[model samples]
Target: MKKFGILVVVFIVCVAFLSSYANADVETEKISLNGSTSMEKMVNALKEGLEDKYPELLIEPQFTGSSAGIEAVLNGTTDIGNSSRYLKDSEKEKGLIENIVAIDAIVIVTDTQNKVNNLTTQQLIDIYTGKIRNWKEVGGEDLPIVVVGREAGSGTRSAFEEILHIEEQCQYANEVNETGPIIAKVQSIHGAIGYVSLDVIDETVKPLAIDGIQASEETIQNGQYSLQRPFVMATKDTIEKQNEEVQKLFQYIQSEDGQKIIRAVGLVPTSNKMSY
Candidate 1:
């Protein structure tokens, strides 16, 4: 339940962000995106469309972590930093701005063999912190719960920890660096559990509900599910305000066609969709 509530803050911030982009001209020739391996799927979906619309443009991307992505743009390493979570206040203080691309719910997944489904925020926190050590503690089989997760620097790990307030203290049984590996481990390993972006979920693992709210497109869009986080593209303010291409790509991500691309990738598009 606590996980769902923090999305309210994200909603407010996104609204303000869209409002700020209202008057800017959304046109550009090229865009270079780096950071957040989680955003790769979304970026790939957009790259073709973005290039088709602006035939002369080049859309390049790199799959780095969110913090590194945000820092890259700030330090002039990339035109846009693709982040899976909202920028930290510290990053914003350094003049970085968050441009939301799509909404992703961080879902807790278990091996399909594990019958335990839903978990409260506290139950999740306790389990990840090593306090609740077995599946039976959460009403499942009496097997040891194998907690798999991403590496410390992953944006998914950051969002999962920050939203659940489990930061730094997560007692992961295994900490892999990418979402794909986490899913694979959870799928093939009995009693394994992990978290991933909603868009990446597959039949290999079961996506459990939280407090009866499933992480579906409708539930996330309607604000019924709370594990959702924004897919942010961060750029330095001075550059964002002045770079026509960057603004164009950002605006396109929020436009109806862009929203379609986002939905195609299994994420919920912002209701505040903009014109191209």
Candidate 2:
């Protein structure tokens, strides 16, 4: 009987030791993210916070168009694709799932030299669609309007057009590839007009009012600003099912801590439970 009891104790000890070892040896998750050049600041914040909290985990992020992010998810090239627009029906059909991470408002801006503080929605549409060619036509100086726009694939363009019902061709003098470029162009060029997320608004340019409403956090939260869109995280079925690291990454993003990073970058958090 004594011998049997000693063996049982030894077996329990070995099981406990092995369990501890297994937990200690658990590998850190590594995830890759792509999409939404507009998410530059937010993604950087995410990287900093995530590394601080879980140094064991690794995350790689890339800036491409939001559509490119969705495609990356579908192609299994990325764990999470950041998108500034909602996922399309075709994307759902292709086995991609979208997780809304934040809400952002599209802000229309003009060169600081223009002195134009306000524009109605129709006036902005007319200006960008080339209906109004001169800044004087929209309560500004008598300068010809230099329309600036994002590239065709930009989620900002899609969301802006959709909100404005701007079916006309983009009548821009130039098409910039990213938000930074657009902001820079608008800042440097007098009579220039462009749009970007409210987070990117700076003193170099002036944000315009739409339909008497400003693109501000309060206005966006109240739905007074009509150009709000959901920023999403995309994942394809192949990666969701087959990639353990990808799954862990999504899980962490949906967690409370992740929402804080989302808000820190000036976008509205999707999760109310997550503290700002």
Tell me the spans in candidate 1 whose CA falls farther than 4 Å from its real position: 1-29, 238-240, 271-276
lDDT of 2 by residue, 123-176 (tens): 888887889999888787889999998888888888888778884566989898
Indicate the TM-score of model 1. 0.85
Please list all clashing residue pairs in model 2, or write none if there are none.
none
Q: All candidates' TM-scores?
A: 0.85, 0.83
* Candidate 1 global lDDT: 0.85
| Separate clash counts for every candidate | 3, 0
Question: Total clashes, candidate 1?
Answer: 3
Cα deviation at 52, candidate 1, in Å, is 1.8
lDDT of 1 at 230: 88
**lDDT, candidate 1, 220-241, per-residue tens:** 9898998889888777774347
